[model samples]
Target: MSESGSSNWAIEATDLYRRYGTLEVLKGVSIRLQRGKMVAIVGKSGSGKSTLLHILGTLDTPDTGTVSVCDVPILNLSSTALSSLRSKHLGFVFQFHHLLPEFTALENIAMPSLITGKSKREAFNRANDILGYLQLSDRASHKPNQLSGGEQQRVAIGRALMNEPDIILADEPSGNLDTETSIQVHQLLRRITTEMGKSLIIVTHNNDLAALSDEIYEMKDGMLFRSEG
Candidate 1:
């Protein structure tokens, strides 16, 4: 791990660049996310919103630039170290719940912890706690197919929180829900940032949800700029 920087920022990425074959996707994209705040990244489809999120979450590598999560610079870490850092400090939620069809909500939520070597007893205890916190305690035994759209997304969010990560990176988290349900999920995400003290970065096209964030950025033509509040 690189030497730690300011603890105040949950993520700090600078001068990022990425390309596929000859297609340049990110052009000097940069962002700094403070702790306990919600940030919204909004743009048209294929504007590189998800690409930036992936780099921040350590799910993808930038062609050039630096990324630091919770003060530790990650660009130079070994794969094993990077994986550990990503698992311990970052959580991800996508447009789809991506829940395992065979697993109950509780089991799905516990999987992350279990993967990190937590015993089933310990993982399930934490999973149950998160389920209660998400107000989905009664749905713990339900498989993804058995839950409503909003419920499944809530379960996904619970799974994200199971590791007690410092930051949550959500890509179009409410994109698949109806407006009413989307608003609820948006509000729930905001609550998680405020109440659980987890910094959140969400990529969305929803203007209403963007308005609820502490900061908003617009991605256009592979560049990012802060939107006027």
Candidate 2:
């Protein structure tokens, strides 16, 4: 484990770099995410903020850097191993809900646990618990199309929690919602982090959400700048 980050830190990225063709995207980006804390990254479009989030979530890799999740170095892990590690230790929420159109909210939320080899009963039990916590118990049986936008997003969040991941990586999670709903989601995410002892890394353009985070960073010119506000 790196001395700079404690054992409880959910994510640690050191000097991360990435390039595409001739375009250099990330430039020596480093970040730390402690469990039960929230961090936000903001930047204009094409500023590489989303790229950094993807690397942190392990959906993409850095060309030169080290990324650790739960103290496990991930660079050399096989695809299968990385899949298993992600299922067990990380969660992701994006702007779109990405739910199966045919599945009920409960079933959708239960999918991750089921994929990780949990029994159907165990998966539903965990899913139901998260739904209740998110105050979506009444909509459990409803399909995605039957729910409102906010409800759909909440179901997506429940799915992310299915395997009890230690860290959540969100990319504009509230961007599609109205202002009131976005604020509600922002507060809800903070409460969830505190209550579940999970860390959050969100890439957003919304200043309101950024303002609510414990630490905020702005990405510009392929570098990170910590924000005082």
Candidate 3:
């Protein structure tokens, strides 16, 4: 869409359109996300930022146009194939830390690997590695209700990263946290992108977090515009 070379892109969407009955949410939106870079999408409510995220994350399909990840078109994949692809390549975080209430933090983080057919032992090992990276090793046995808000969010991020996904999609990852916690979460996200070389695409309304990204784009009226350096 921007005349960018396709080789550099981890996710690409072209002429994407979406509709909810009489309301058209996305109108010819296109984006090119480069590998190992963090891009932030910001907009007011009802601007279609979340819709774009769902499409890119393979959770939903566009009504028209194409969406691809690492040059693989996902729009037409079988449900099983899409599920496998999402499990192996894409990670997602939401505003709410959706950890299973009955599971410990470690178990929660290990769920993705388990769902992907890894042995329980193997999954827990990988989960341990990510929890340690996020400085949550001490809280491994704690359930979601037993951990602090920041710790729970960290666990959620750990779960998303458990499978070594190529891209991470976060929608208002710190929306429920206080200002200080949100700042810490933002820094953690930046560190992950920089140190792990993981591509991150985040949809958020917080300017501070957006400013920390490698690129920032604004969504308005179903269109995107470059917002800042």
Candidate 4:
């Protein structure tokens, strides 16, 4: 399957395992996510959900496993190749907004494009388009500190979308927001998959929010189990 490109899967993983010292975090976990769908992973704080997400996002390596993103095998790629692949195909959102303090929301959103050598005019043009899409056109000139928590997260989401990634992996994306704001973020995430046709996998603890996903999984004892109704 590693060499096959005909499959419609956005991400496919098999026999994923990871460890730290004597502790095993992931135990032979595997998953396949389709395009334009959303999957939610729910687990306790110490569970391996975040570790699995990091591995899937190529931010961390597994002790043993194979991962293919957009049908490209990832395990054996060189660091430079991996970084390039990650930047081109994957987007990430974390609990904290992680926006740069000095840059305006527009600049932060344009940073990824700039790093990839896009001209400022091209980058900012796309950034403005994204700001409009995110309904934050007025906040583009505001810095992270000036925006509300939800707005800051929306800026981070805009930054993620700037690269036009195939899949989005979010780790507690709404973890720090109030209930209403979290609900808005959750709805926006759902929209990303449904309206924008991007695959989404989110690691979150909120069961109510998890219920909104197309698929749900639970992590426990370093193992992943599909949740059933």
Per-residue C-alpha lDDT of model 3 across residues 29-100, encoded as one tens digit per residue: 999989889999999989999999999999999999899887789967999989888887899999999899
Kindly provide the TM-score of model 4 when superposed on the true structure, using C-alpha atoms.
Answer: 0.96
Please list the C-alpha lDDT of all candidates, in the order they appear: 0.92, 0.89, 0.90, 0.92
Note the residue pairs that clash in candidate 3: none
lDDT (tens digit, per residue) of candidate 4 on 1-229: 1125557898999999899999999999999998889999999999999999998898998989899988889978999999999998899999998999999999999999999998999999999999999999999899999999999999999999999898899999999999999989989999988888899999998999888899999999999999982
- Residues 157-182, model 2: lDDT tens digits: 99998888888898999989999998
Off by over 4 Å in 1: 1-6
Question: Which run of 10 residues does model 4 get worst, by summed lDDT?
Answer: 1-10
Candidates in order, TM-scores: namely 0.96, 0.95, 0.95, 0.96
* lDDT minimum window of 10 residues, candidate 2: 1-10
Question: Residue 10's C-alpha lDDT in candidate 4?
Answer: 88
Q: Which residue pairs does candidate 2 place in steric collision? A: none
Candidate 4 RMSD to the real structure: 2.2
**Where is model 2 more than 4 Å wrong at Cα?**
1-6
Q: Model 4 segments beyond 4 Å from truth?
A: 1-5
lDDT of 1 at 40: 97
TM-score attained by model 3: 0.95
